[model samples]
Target: MRLRNKPWAKEEMSKYPHIVIPNPKECKGNWNKVFGNNQPIYVEVGTGKGQFLSGMGKLYPNINFIGIEKYDSVLVTALERIKETKQENVKFLNEDVENLLEFFADNEIERLFINFTDPWPKKRHEKRRLTSEGFLRLYEQVLKPGGDIHFKTDNQGLFEYSLHSFSKYGMILNNVSLDLHQSDIEGNVMTEYEEKFSKKNMRIYRCEAVYRD
Candidate 1:
């Protein structure tokens, strides 16, 4: 799934040099000091090519952003963009989101974003999905009380399932949108996956869920 013609992506990626870590043990329990003073940190679970992460990092200099993407192929671009901006407010992690708590301290994050995460549509594979209850607990353990989970996806079934998951976890849902682009919310940045899916006229689902605990 190489996107060679994306010159903008290439140019943006060329700006930042990446520091890839193979050992999750290295980042474990050290992220609190990485971004300097906590600084209202936010993380995107699967930041493909870093489109959303880099975009937001540039816009919000006060809030530190971390793009947690396990795939090197996609993360390379994201790393380059952060370097280009000379943005000190962001970092990229090439690792699975499954063990997120090991890398972050308790209630370390202020917000979590799951932009078009893998749906794992098969009934038998439901638990493996990122929005599953098990994964939500990982998020809950790190997100501060009253912190929010903002998610967007074109997958109807995943969106529906996630709604139930959020409610089941005692998270309040607000600002629900069945069609995001048509909404009046300004500066709603589009991720790489979002742009591709929207071309087919797929309805986008977005919501904010507050972590009660």
Candidate 2:
């Protein structure tokens, strides 16, 4: 399903008013100005409810973060989360990820994050999955060469499918974890979905995919 419009809903965030982008279109190819001189920009493509990005922005002040969500209703929740922190290092785009090239210059984004994206389980609907080859091409356009996309999901099927898709695109994978919560990495930020499904004993698969030059 395509997402509708409502830039004001997010634009009106008052608490962490700094997080709200005055004009997202202006940041196009000029994101560096938002983060000061030169800082790494990390993007969360489907930042549902903003739990992860908000927490991450608070934790890493030097790294600039942007959340891209097509759905306005869901993005409002994330906007509200950042409100509590007043983190200036965070921003968002209430737009589809398909227009990534328009929002950013080639090789602009340093890192990408895909967290518990819609699986698009049906074989006929495979193209709808964010990890599809066509979508991966869009990622490559915005992601800096040698840059990486980190993915986390509780769906085994999507993880398996994404693993194949990454390989098909000649991307390199490392630090792949079948069960993320069980790993030794401390202080891992958990999203609302990750916290909910993990209690049900579902295995969480995570991996970092680096696009080859």
What TM-score does each of the candidates earn? 0.86, 0.90
- What is the C-alpha lDDT profile of model 2 across 1-213, one tens digit per residue? 345565666546533434655457667888998767588999999887899998888888899999988776778878877667777788877788887887888888999999999999999999988899998999898888898998999999999999999999899999889898888756678888898988898888999899987
Clashing residue pair totals per candidate (backbone < 3 A): 5, 0
All models, RMSD in angstroms: 4.0, 3.0
lDDT of 2: 0.84
| CA-lDDT, candidates in order | 0.80, 0.84
**Candidate 1: lDDT of 74?**
75
Query: Where is model 2 more than 4 Å wrong at Cα?
Result: 1-18
Q: Which candidate is the best by lDDT?
A: 2
**TM-score for model 1?**
0.86
